[model samples]
Target: MKLLLLNLIFLSGSAAAVELNADGILNSLIDEFVSCVNDSAGPIHQAAMRLFWLLVPINLVISGIRCVFNGDFSDFFFSLVTSVLFTGIFYYLLSHDYAIGKSIIDSFVTMVDDDYMGPSELIDLVFNIDRQINNLMTSNVLGLVSKLQIVICMIVFSVVMFFVILRFVSIYLTAQILCVIGVFVLGFGGLKATRYLAVNYLKLLISKGLELITVLIITKTGCRILNDVIDATKLYEEGLSVLKHSECMVMIFISLFIFVLSKSLPPVMSSLMSGTSGGFETGLGLSLKKYRFLISRNSGK
Candidate 1:
């Protein structure tokens, strides 16, 4: 059910991208990104590790600054480290033998082919894919499906573990945060000093998530637009395609706009609220309440 909701959310304004055979591309990207970072760290691996840890927070601070200026933060839960994980996973998904890229193209083609029955076509595509998947499940000769499911489960488990580790680290860091607050209370006796740290940390988190989501949305949108632009010349000869389908194109554009807006708004709101004296506390509380309401509403839906 959660997966279904995530899929819907991801597909809200956009069609799924084409399933490119991107295994090589994924590995290459990971290697390049990692190697660049490592090269920047010089010869010693331990020194590199320390520098990387230090740099991660700096990146988050940078993201926060960018978010403040932009007034839009979406998907900021993903920090620099987590964003790297996400990017790697994304690259893997795009590069792997997953026919997601092809499926995306097929969807576009199908949508374009039958303009009048867009909804019905979507349903048919779902069911057709479902039928094929069911057949694969029932056959199970190569155990490919089972292996894939296990891999997915492992990925999910790893994510859960990451969150668990993050929680522990946050808890461990709380003592230092409190110590700083303690010193402030003792030195000049200002409780407001504590507020600064708390607010900044919260801003950091919001900014990070927003930036990560922004990257994902931007990359995905770029891919879709590029594909459409490239296919423009051959769209006529290619029979029905997304670019040829006005309705789909409109939907895609609207969806992308919403994605960009949603990602941008949160951090802007956070930054604005933080700038005022009591605004951060009030806004943070309200945001939390609103988020709770949203979760409840979505859950019910």
Candidate 2:
């Protein structure tokens, strides 16, 4: 029941792009996504700088105190040293407007724009395709079915194109939110019990990177099909049905095929690599398990 409803939602525009920039939609979206990330990330960097002075030392002291209670003197010494070194490295990476963070974000965008989609080639192709559809819409010779085919292809293709770019907005924004909060989680690094919280945060960053790589492969395939559609659209001319030019039928089916893959591929790709994030036992994980057991026990009482 829920699955059917989910499929219905997937077909809707909300699954893809919220807003389309008809003027320079694709590139403008790409540009805007990059812009929004840089803007939101600024105050985060500044706040981290401020907190570097205040919270890091405090966290270290707390960790050091906890270490004394939890471990031997040698263990506490090494943990403090390790925490200081790790924190220093993290701070350096985040310094200068989060060069590391922004670089990671840029790499994802590059994979879509520069690599998979082929910037001008892809965008120019979309424009060319849109212009052809415009021509067909203007043509009085084409019947309803023919016109509907072209219109559906154009709409689905546009959605997939915009979705491919806009998808990163959610990712980058989530990453920004994580950074703002996750910086403090790094403080737990010195304590063995809660250290996994910090480790998991790093793991999540890598997971997002890996997710982009998967999306890049999907985008590459979609763009290639789109390129073929461009070639097929050339087969159209005055008063000719797709029956006469079978290329139009083939093109419509394949273009529609892309929209299905756009929704289906991510979950398939993610499932195949399900072990990427989990599979490790951490002190925090163990503590959470114990905590949950006690909560359940108290509820039974």
- The pairs that clash in candidate 2 are none
TM-score per candidate, chains pooled: 0.23, 0.63
Best by lDDT: 2
Q: Which residue window of length 10 is worst by lDDT in model 1?
A: 182-191
Note the Cα lDDT for every prediction shown.
Answer: 0.36, 0.55
Candidate 1 displacement at residue 176 in angstroms: 21
- Give per-residue CA lDDT, model 2, range 30-138, as digits (tens): 4444444456665665665675556567767886788778865644655565567656655665554455554665575576565535433455566777887687667
Off by over 4 Å in 1: 1-195, 233-301
Residue 216 local lDDT, model 1:
33
Cα shift from native, residue 255, model 1 (Å): 18
